[model samples]
Structure formats: structure tokens, C-alpha cells
Target: MRLLAVLDRVDTAPFTLEALAGLLNRLGPAQSRILHVAPSRDPDYLSPDEGMPDAAEHARFEHTVSAQTDTLRQIAQEWTQAVIPHRDTAWTERVGDTRTLVAREAAGADITVLSRPSPQDNAAVAEAFAGALYDAGAAVLIAPLEHYATLGLRPVVAWHPSHTLDLALQAARPILERASHVTFVIGENAPMEVPDPPLGAELARQGVAVHMDRFLLDTGDIGEQVRQHALSAGGDLLVMGAYTRPHFIEWLFGGPTQDILAHGTLPILTRHAPLVRL
Candidate 1:
């Protein structure tokens, strides 16, 4: 597997790097790359509405990047050495459009990993996420804010029937096949009458141990409910579809995917559905 870890901020990257290393261990020896894409130098691109960065803002941005450069390198070196004992790894930083750069890099990767977005750096994070999942059509692993040694040992799938879920399951098959145990949290949208859902049945055929439970939507916030159940069940990773609704709509009204990204603590394996054209 080729794993790409996209860093949004030097401070938050340790968790992402940890998750990347853990995923490398979980998925077996693989090539991994750590990438940081800075925003384009063009002032217009940086602030389209203003059409340029004010002198003070420009100075602050440059200072921030300069100050973080050494720290970024140190963290990258540490993680690179840490992973080198088990697999091949490298790190690089580039200045460009985040979305385009991330999409280009992720195109060659089996899975792209990223630090969960924070309020301070959400724009860049969102751009990178869009580039990887939406543009490159790649599966993304959003690392938890907290550190985790490893994941996929016991992954919980938030299950429902949809094209998005189908893609997510397919992308996560490697993890599922290797998991010690797999739990399916059946959403209210799923058919309850069936003793075995298609996904669970397929995993069972593959000799993977599987379990299931009901997740009624009306119970409360779906994201919170899923997170609690997974944690309570000892789940180390969360596997589910992302962004079922339009991105703008989700940003405005909120959706389960957004809710999970904002507050859930589990490392999430997710993929967006392909865009349809008339």
C-alpha cells in the first residue's frame, strides 16, 4: 500500500504521523510519504475577496511559515526514522494550491491520511480533503486528535445502504479482511429484518468475525451515537461513507459526516461518492 500523510499544521501533524505509522503497521510494510503543501504565493489566490494580502497579514504569514519550518522538519525526521525501521518513508514540503497538490499526490496513493481539521486551519484542511477524496477519488483516513498506537484491530463500520457506503466498504476491505473483529452499527436506514446484511455476510464468507447492532437515528445525534457505541465496544477505528449531501449543505446544516469530523475522536476511514453528470 502507498500511504500519503498530508500535513495541515506542524503542531497537529504528530497525530497524523502517528496514525500514518500505525496504518503502515496495520496494513503491513508499505511505502509512505509525508507532504505539506503551502498556499500559493499569489495574493489574489490567498484572499480572493480582498484580492491581496495586506502588508501586516503577509508579514505574519511569512513569519509563521518560517518559524514552523524547523519544527516541521524535526517532526518529519523523527517519524521518518520511526517508520524506516519497518518500512520506506520520506517527507517533503511544497508551495502550491493545496487542493491541486493534494489531489495530484493522492492519485498515486492507496490511501491518503490527514489530521482532522481545526478551526484555526480548517480552510487548508478542507481544501486538501476535497482534493484527495473528491478530486482524486481516493479513500481518506482522518486521524484522531489524540494519539493512537495502532488501529483496524477492531474497526466499527457505521452501516447503511448507499453508493457512498459501497465505495467506503470497498476501499476499506484490506483493513476489514485483516481486522481481529469487525462490528457493524446498522443505521436506521438499513433493513432490520435481515439477520445478516450484505456487508456482514460478505465478511463472514471471507472468514472475518463480525457483529452487528441497531443505531436508531431518533436516539440522538447520529455521529455522537456512533462514536460512543464504537468506543464503548472497544473500536479502534471508524469505517463509514462521507459527505452524502452536497458539501455546502453539510457545511451549513451539518450532517453525520461533518458531525463526526468535528467532534468524534475515532480515526475515520471514509470516501465520498463519485459526482454524477447529466
Candidate 2:
């Protein structure tokens, strides 16, 4: 898969490089591009009635932004070689909104990889990048700061009888094919009509050691149970379909898939259902 990784000047963490390397290694010799996006420094005005900044302040902000961009280029150069070992990998720099830039660049690529933002920067560039790519119909991989390569190929698939689950499996087919073991976790009280047995068998046919387990949660904390199962199974990556309903729709009608997304801590590989069929 052709993958594009967006790096922002403000988000400089060592784990970002490690995550890129891991993703490239997992994807084999696919074409990968590292793009550095310069963060805008202009203070956004809340309304038209708000006064503009003085000329001196605006010039200072512009100068600061230029300096930051230069620093970003240097950082990108250092991080690119460290993260992407292959000589064929290409790097570029762009000046614009990171979210918009990534969405445009990821259009033709099969997948996009993004590092999770630091807790202090929860609503930071990473979230914007993820939302933009996902909204653009690209498969996204969100990597945590922890060293994930040491976790090995054993993975846990959080399964539900939904199209999103199928999409996640399809997007993670490469990993699943190479995984030593795959554990499917399902709700104990879920309806018997759930058709995951065939899916499990299919994975087994692809050389993955597959097993299914059911969990009963009295506290109704299914998210906690899923996380526990993955950890107990020694999973390196957690595969799940991302729930993509409108905020209002989900608020009134609860979604276990959304709950899992909110609580999952492992590197999550997700694809929207409609994209999966493609």
C-alpha cells in the first residue's frame, strides 16, 4: 500500500519516528512518503468585529512561523532517515493546514499512518490529521508512543457483527496473515445469530492461529473487558472497526464499537465499512 505520513513541527516526539518505521516494515516494500507540514502561527480571530493584530505583532508572528518551518525541515530530515531506512522513501515539505494537506495527499494512497498526540495536546495536529484522512475515505493507523515492535505479531480482533469489523479485518489483512495468533473477543450475551465463526475459519485458512472467546460483563463495561482481553492475549496490535455514526445518533443510541474506540490503547488499524468493499 502507498502510505503517506504527515509530520508537524509542533509534534516532535521520538515515538513518532519509531511508529513510522514499524508501519513501513509491516507493509513490506510499499512506497512511503514523509511530508512535513508547517503549522500556522496566526492567531485566529473569533469574529469579524475582533480587531486585527498590529503590524509589528503580525510581522513577528510571520517571522516566528518561518523559523518554525525551517526547524521543521531539519527535524523532518533527521527523523525521515531514522524512521524510513529504505533509500527509495521520499520526503517533502508543504506550508498549509496539516489536516487539509494530508487529506489531499492521502487520496491516492492505500493507507495513512499518524502518531497519537500527547495527552497535553489532545486536540492537537494528530487528531486533525486522523479526522481528515478518515473523512477522505483512507484507511488510518494510529500509533501510540510505546515501542510496539517488541509486542510481536500476536493480535486481538475486537469483533462485532458489523460492516466496520469486516472493514478493519480487510485493512489489517497483511498483519493478520503474518500474525502467529489471533484472538476474537465477542460479547457473551450477544445474539447467537452473530456470524463470526466463518470469519475465524477464514483467518485460520490464511495461516493465522485463530481462536474465539466470549466475555460476560456484569458492570456493562465492555470496553474494559476488550482491553483486558487484548492485554491478556499479549496482543501487539488491536484490530477493530471504527464506529462512524453522527455524534447525535450515537449519543442517543449507544454503540459498543464507539466504546471500544474510546478505550482502546493499542495501535489501532481501522477502515470505514464502505471503503472496505472497495
Candidate 3:
């Protein structure tokens, strides 16, 4: 499997980098593509509405960006070596409006990995992650800030029999098929007995040893519910479908996906595609 791991600054210095390295180990020798998106000079970057200065400022900024890309390329190689040691990897840099590029590039990726976005995170990182998750046409795994030695070793699936869950399960098969222990936490939306063949049967067909339980308390607090259940069940990773409502709607009222991203204690695997977010 291959992953498009987008870096906000491509600097592998933070706990974010360490966390990514840990998640990479969990995937078991997969190819990695590193895409760096940031202003070359600083953490803060001005968007178009913020206004730009003269031609000199523009040229200088472009040069700085080019220089940073070179630096990031070197860093990508060095970090991957120190982290994964012997994994196939490639590196690239993106500047300016990268939404379309991220979507196109992530089309063939099994998963698009990004550092979990925080309220304090740069606006650029938030924009990139939003675009990637909404448009990548694949699952996106938001890596936590804490470094983990391994992920997906013991996994919990927050499941409800639906198209979204099916897509999520399909995307997570690589991890599911390899998990030592797998638990399925049936969310509030799930019927007592799935109408069609149970999801557990499908997972069984894929050779996943699994069990299920009900998750009904604190239904509004999806993140806590998933977190408590998974950790209690000894899971290292949490798998669930991505944003189902329009991104604007979710951002406005917040949703389960948003709650999980904000407070969940584990790495989250989410799948959404071709979002028509307004």
C-alpha cells in the first residue's frame, strides 16, 4: 500500500514527525510520498485576501520558497532514513494554491496522512487538510501529536452498516487484515441486527478476528465514546468513515468527525471522497 503523507512545513522536527514515523511503522513497509506545503520563510503565510506587496516581495518570496523546498527534500530523505530506515519513499514540494494538486496526487494513494489539525495550527495546514480530506477521493489518517511505536496492531472500528462504513472498512482492510485483535464498536446509528449480512461477516471473510459492542452513552460525544471503547478494548488505532455532511455544515455545528479529530486520543482513519463542500 502507498500513502501520501502531507507535511505542513515538511519539517520532521516536531512530535508530529515522530508521530508520523510511528504510524508509518504500523503500516508495515509501505511506499511513502512526502508532500510539503508551506511558505518558505516562516510559519505564517498571507493568503490572497491578505494582500501582496510589490514585485520584489513576490520574487523574494518565490526564491525563499524554492530554497525551502530544496531544504525539505533533503530533510525528507534524512528523516525517513532515521525513522523508517528502509522504506521506499519520494519527496516533493507544493506552494501557492495546492488544493487541486493534493486531490489529484492523492487519487491513487491508499491513505492520505496528515498531522491532526488543532485550533492553534496554522491556517495553511488547516486548509490543506480540509482540501485533502474533502477531495482526495480516499481515506485520510489524521496522526496524533504523540509518537506511537506501532499503530493498527490492535484496532477498533466504529461501525454502522452503511455505505460510508463500507467505504471506510474497504480502505482500512490493510490494517484490519493484519490486526492482532480487532473490535467493532457499533455506534448509535447501527441497528440491533444489521439488515443485510452483518459487517462482522464481511470482516471475517477478509480474515479479521473481530468482536462487537454497543456504544450508546454520550452519543453526542462521539470522540470520547470511541476513545474510551477503543482504548478499553486495547486498540492502538481507531477506524471510522470521514465527514458525511457538507464541510461547512460540520464546521458550523461540528459533527462526529470533527469531535473525534478534536479530542480523540488515538490515530484516526477516515474516508471521504469528492466532497462538494461549499
Ranking by lDDT: 1, 3, 2
Residue range 1-278, candidate 3, lDDT tens digits: 77777776544334445545655676677777888775543333356666655778777767877776777677777777876466666887665565666767777788887776656555566666656667665677777767666788888888755666677788887777777778888656644543333656766777777787675555367666777888798877888866565562354137755666666778787777454448
lDDT of 3: 0.68
Candidates' C-alpha lDDT: 0.79, 0.65, 0.68
TM-score of 3: 0.79
Quote the positional error of residue 173 for candidate 3 in Å: 0.7
CA lDDT of 230 in candidate 1? 85
lDDT of 2 by residue, 1-278 (tens): 77766665345434555555666666677887776665453534435676676789788877976786677667667766655455366777776566577777777677666666443443236434554345566676666656666332777888876777776677677777777888887766655545675767888988779988677655767777888888888887887766665331242126655455445667767666433443
* Top candidate when judged by TM-score against the true structure: 1
For model 3 the local lDDT of residue 184 reads 85
Deviation in Å, model 2, residue 18 alpha carbon:
1.7
TM-score of candidate 2 on Cα atoms, chains taken together: 0.80
In model 3, the runs with Cα more than 4 Å from the true position are 10-29, 38-50, 54-74, 188-197, 202-207, 218-220, 248-253, 273-278
Alpha-carbon RMSD, each predicted model:
2.7, 4.3, 4.0
